[model samples]
Each structure stands twice: as C-alpha cells, then as structure tokens.
Target: MDDIMRAIFACIPGMRSPASPGGCLSAAFGGGDDDGEEGEGEGEDRISRLPDAVLSSIVSRLPVKDGARTAVLSPRWRRVWASTPLVLDDADLLPDDDGPQIFWRDVADAVSRVLAAHPGPFRCVRLTNACSYAGSRGAAALSRWLGVLAAKGVQELVLVFLHAWPVRVEPPADVLRVSSLRRLYLGLWRSFPDTEHLRPGADVFPNLVELGICRTDIKAKDLDRLLQCSPALETLAFVVSYNTQPNVRVRSRSLRCVLFWMSIAEELAVVVAPRLERLILWNGCPCTRRVRRDFRTRVKIGYTPELKVLGYLEPRIHVLEIANTVIEAGTKPSPGTMVPTVKVLAMKVRFGVRQEAKMLLSFLRCFPNVETLHIMSAEADEPTGKLNFKLKFWQDVAPVECLKAHIKKVVFKNFRGERSELAFLRFVLERAQILQTLVVVLTDGDGDHASQEELGNRLKPLIYSTHRASKCAEFFIFVRCGGTSWSFRTASDLSRSDPFDC
Candidate 1:
C-alpha cells in the first residue's frame, strides 16, 4: 500500500505522498475543491460526480479485482459496485510479481467471494482457471459457487475447466437450472444434464440463446435433449471432443448456425432446422496425443431451406447427402440432388486427383444457387487414379451453371500453380462471366527469386489470356503458411459471411 502511494506521489513534483494506497486513490478519483485547480480546473473528481448508473457501468467493465478495489475510492463508488450487475473473469485474478503466489484453490475461493458479494444479476462471467477440486471438499466448493451463480441469475457464463484431460469431473446439475442464462459455454465437462423426462412445464435452459459445448462427453440423446430444452438457441457448436462420437441430429427451429470442428463424430444431419444458415466443418484430423479416430463425418442436409453458407467439405472425408440421397462421384446432378438455398459454398478438393475432381464437380452441382465459392486446393498424397487431370476435365464436364451465372467471387486456397491448378484458374477466368473478385492463396513455393519471377510470368499469362469472361474482375495473390488456429467465435461468426475472405 505504502509503495503504491509513493509511486503515485513520485509522478507529481510538489504533492506530498499519502501514507496509504486508499488515500492516494481517494485523491486521484475522489478529489476535493482544493485539488480542482491543480489540473487547470479539469480535476474536479468528475468521475465521482457521475450518476450512480454511469459509475456502475464503468465499474462493471473492469476486472473483478479492479472493480472491487474501486470501493476504496468513495462510499458512492462502493455503493455503485454493490448495485451494478457483476461481470467477473477468473483470468484477471492471477498473481502479480509483487503479490503472493495464487493457486487454483485461492482463485476459486476469490471467485466465490466475488460472486457472493455482488448481490444479483451477473451480466457475464468467465471462469477459466485450472482449478482441480481434488475430492469431496473440491466438489463441495464447486457446488457452492455454482449455487451462488444459479441464485444470482447469471446472463452469460463461460466455464472452461483446465484440469487434466480424461478425468472430467462433473459439475452439479445446477448448470441446467440457470434459466436466467442467455448464453453459456462449457468446456471439458463430462455431460450436460438430461432433462428429457422433466415435468410438463418444467424449464430447462429456457432462456439460453447461444450454447457452446467443447471437449465434453455428450451423447446423441443428451444433445437432442439440450436442443429440446433450449428453444431460443440460435447458435450451437460442438468442438473437438474425441471421447464422444455423436451422430448429431439438428432438430431445432431456432438454430441458425452449427459449427463442428476437429470432432470425432459419425454424422451431422440437419433433419429439421428451418432457420439454419451455416454448417461449418473444419478438421477431421486426429488430436496431437490421441490415437487417430476415423475422420469421415457423413453430412446429411434435409429440411434446411434457409441454409446459405456451407462447407470446407473435404471431397474424400465427408459423405454428402441431400434430400435423403447420398452424393457420389458418379451421381448425375438433378433437381432432386440439389440444395438450391445454399449461396456461399466452400470445398476442399485435390484438383490433381481425377476422382476428387469429379466429386468436387458433383458437390458444386448440388449447390446450384451458390454465388460466392471458396476452393481449398488440397495436397494429394497417392494418386486416386489418373494424375494431372487437366483443363480438358473442366472443359468437358457438364457446364457448372453457377460459374456462368451466379458466382461473383472465388477464392482458391493453397494455389501451388501446378498444371491442374493453373488449368482450373484458366477455366474459372474463362467461364465465370459475372465473377467480381478472384483470390489465389499460394502454398509458399520453395523456388528461388528468379524461379519466382518465372512463376509470376506464368500466372500473368493465365490471368491475361484472350478470354473476356468477366470484364471488371479484380485479382489478388497471397501466401498461406499453415493457417490460423480455429476457434468457435471465428467459425460461428455469421458476420464473416465468407471464412476464406481473409
């Protein structure tokens, strides 16, 4: 306290240092009439004079400790802190260099105290400390804090347990009881409560609008129940849970976006989602330490008429089904096979492989209304039959209707400038009559400076052929090192419209 006061005093030349930190803060924010002229008549503790509502708003935005510390400023501010809706984040309570080492137990205790102190109506709270409630005592601690939150009516809550994997300690079913929650994210939990057999009018997550479950052990039935309970849920995300293999059936009328990332799941069936717009699937690859689970996740699209954004659909990995028909490489594109509602589409294709190229064609044919297209050029390991399936394939295939009419933008990722890749670029440049922008994200060639110049010259020839498909098209080139680390916020953000626009 003395040191903090001394530091504040050191900043001012003639001002005497306060003996206590509280006095220093009082002088800073709770200044009297004498201090008003010190800073050119602008030092009249204007913050302290603010209306209680305005002051409470300011305090609510601060970290838990910082907001609570404002109490020492004045009785008015103290009252403000007490009255304002609590916004706590456990990450903000970490130990400083001068402070004593803070263990998880200490943080948990502090969080409990903070939750208890603030009377009611928690606006947003994120608890991400690696707190291992070891035994019965820890279990009791968890229940006590969760009980506080449930009683207080927390609106938005994100609880990420950073404990050791595989030992997912189940938090009490009090989680489902927080009917006040409008948004909830639970990471590394065992399971969500099964409220399937609840009484006639029993409320289960009645107010939850956005629910995110990550690395949790969830069953298909429980997932269904969660959906059934959360009638207002507009967005649902299941991310990277190797322990659970859920054949997710989307049966919610309110769900607009579903993000499935790095999860070892069997299938995702949009059976009854009328409002669903985006179905984003990232990696099916295995996690770093775990034994590789089979990556195929059959995607079935049924009753989703409002669906607009689709994919990162790997040609080899995902088995696409539309209107109860499984989309195959040889399946002819017809009215029954198409999803006419999809506008923005993304696909992972190995243009070098003949089968995948054909599959890519089939997938494109299925989405006839696609306006903006993103093609991720996947690297081929072993040839899936004939190699370097060139421009002839693109020229000979049944005309891709979207290319000639609907497509306004196309982003080709990992553009290695191979014969097949260049041929496709030539194909698009020649065919997409309405194309507005073309982006080529290269795979960062190993060529030297001179070789790079030669490659550039080659690309220019493709960019400027005797073709006049789109007269006003702009072009750009970028290098893709690996990629950005995926997150729920980035993937499920409907605002991004095009994930590959970057």
Candidate 2:
C-alpha cells in the first residue's frame, strides 16, 4: 500500500527524477484532478462517464457474485449489475458449516435476488448440484431455480448433477415448458427418473438445437420421446454407462453430429441417421463371449450411410487401433462382407501370439476407397514377445499390390525402419500405383541416440534408392529424438514436378 501511494506521489513534478516510471509525480499531482474534471463536464466526458450499456456488457460477462461486487466501485455502478442480465454457474455452491438447508437457503436467496435485480431475460443459466445425502434436497432446490430461469426465458441452459447417493427425483416440468430455450446440456449421475412418469401429451423443447447428456440412465422409449420433443435438435451427445437398455429408438433427421458411448442391449436395430455426417461410438463394454463364441454368427458392425467419422466401436478392435493394443486371435473372417463407403477408416488391434494379417487383409479389402491408412504397434516391456507376431502380420499385410490405385498416402508413427517397416514400404512401393508420397518417421524410445540414427540411415537408402520404386514414390523421413534433431524430407525431386500439384 505504501509503495503504491509513494509511486503515485512521485508522479508529481519536482518530486523525483523527470524519467520516473509512468511519471509517478505527474500522475499523483494531476491525475486525480483531471479524472474529477472529466467526470463533471469539459475535457473528456466520454472517458469520464462509464456508459450504462458498457457497464451492463461488463457485468453480463462476469458471474453473478462478481458482477454484484462491481457495484461498490462507484455510485454510477450501484444499479448497473442489478440489471446486467443473470448468468449463474451452480457449481459455485460448496458445502458450508451453516448446514445443507441453510446453505441451500442462502443459494436460493442469492439466485432470487439476482433474478429480481436483472429485469430482462437471462442470456445463460447453468444450475449444477451434487448430493451427499440420500435425499435429493439439492436437486429439489435446483428445480426451483431452473423454474425461475425458465419463466425469465433464458436462451442457454445447462444442468449437471452428480450424486454420491441414488435418490428418486422428479425434474421440474416447467423447464421444458420454456419456449425461448435454444441450447441445453442436462446430465444426471448416480440414477435417473422413472420413464413412465413422463407428463402426458407434453412437447416442450421445440427450439432446442444442441442437447448433450452424460452419465444418465435414459431408457430407449424415453430417449425417443425426448428426441421427438426436440425436433430442431442438430447435435446430440450421449455419454452412457452401465447396462442401459434404451428400447425406444432415437432418430434425429436434423442432427449433423452424433456421439454415443453406450451399450445397446440388442443389436443396433435402428442405426439410421440420414443426415448424420459424424458418428462417434466409444463402446466401453467388450464383446461378450456369448456373441464372439458363436462362430456361425459373425458380428456384423452396422453404421449410418453418410457417416464420415466412425471409430472406437468395439473393444479388442485390433484392426482399429494397431498403435496401442495388440491382436490376440487370428481368425479368418468370411469374405463378401459389404464395406460401407467411408472416406476415412482408423483401426487398432490388441497384440497377441497369433498375428491378424489375414483378418486385417480381409478387413482392408472391405475399404476399397480408403485414401489414407495408418498402422502402429503396442509399446511393451517385452517388445519381442507380441511384437514379432505383429511384425509378421505387417509383413503379410504389406503387399503393395493390396493398396494399389486406391491408397495415395501412408503414415506410420513410432516407425523404427525395422525389417517389418521395410517390408511394409516394399509393399507400398510395389502396390500403390497412384501413391504420391510415403512418410516414415523415427521416434526416439529409451533415449537411444544410436538407434535413432540407425533408423534414420535405414530410411534414407529406401527413399533415395532407384532400384525398384513406385512410379509416384516421393519419400519423406523424419528422425525425432528428444525434440533436438529433426530430419524431415529425406528424398524428393522438387525440380522434376510439384509435390502438391494435385
């Protein structure tokens, strides 16, 4: 405090050196008078008087309590925050020693005050409450707050509640009754409400565009009803867990993106999304032995027609994530499985003794139009154990002829330029007729500098050699070791033709 005061005093002339920082002496002597004069009439009234609209904008950006605190700055700001437009974050509620009831009472009081203070409809309202007690007191309290906001016609509303205990609670029906609600994210953890308890002939959310839910138990029929209510919904995210069997089908015609990480009890009965562009399925549950055990009933993965991004559908999907997990079983799948016409396909397999070259080869045969293919191996203490089989799989799968004309680019990360890598390259060089460029990067593992250089040297010969290279072979090799050295673009004939001519 003394330092600041002294700095301000030093801004005046003849108080300190002429080259004082921020002209401390000049500021101290003239700053306050200039500011006072500006506040009254002449000089700069624009700079002096804070506009009500600007104050409201500033308050609107800040949370409830912070905006209210700004009132103490000056007399002009006394009623500014009151009508700034409420945007509350319910996570601001923490356990107080005053007991849960009092705590909730205070919270309700604050919300009521803020709502009363702000005249117009709130732009954003977020009410999230967690429960420690078995009874849903917090949820009940939150319902009242949401009801108030709904009445005010808030535009954006988010409600997330994670309960430590399972409690039966009914949602405030009035929240859905809000006509002005456009975007909503509602998530309930621990348990969910009874689906049969829904209000009859209710269709409330007509203006909602984006609906996101997490850790919620929504039955199929109930979900379908909910989707039906939100006819204008464009994007939907359902982070489902546990054995949630949603029997009711959900169809979103306006939806462009759909993310589902849940377990559907029955096989995908209604996997139809006509306008869906991106479909992300992160199946947390592994395929049951009941399903995989029946060799006759080969699990057929079904997806929407127009899906551009589809991944992480099943566990032990070794063909999907070759970089992390390894392939365990090597079963030759029957041919004639119709492959969906998708632009991008990413696959990885869990590593095991039996290599899945045949299975992968069969799978790759499905993707005739795949433009890019990426393959990686798992990192393990015993690299030789599972790696050898994986290497063999790569060797068998890498017959350039298999990827000819279709695949134009291939990227191999954690590449060491080993025999497996060389064999893969040989396959590319032989098969990919329209292959424009091939990139092999060496990433340092175990801080081995010698190994990094060895990998780099091994890649250089493969790229520069003119023995038997692909017609469109343009190689690029990058050796990245500890972020110090990077050698990208090992071989390229820039003078001959433009690399990116297409």
Q: What is the C-alpha RMSD of each candidate to the true structure, in Å?
A: 8.5, 12.7
lDDT per residue for candidate 1 within 302-361, as digits (tens), equals 998899999889876789998889999878888889999889998988887787888888
For 239-267, candidate 2 gives per-residue lDDT tens digits of: 54334552324475666565554333343
Per-model TM values vs. the true structure: 0.84, 0.64
Candidate with the greatest lDDT versus the true structure: 1
Clash number for every model?
A: 0, 30
lDDT at position 122, candidate 2: 79
Query: Model 2: which ten-residue window has the lowest total lDDT?
Result: 485-494
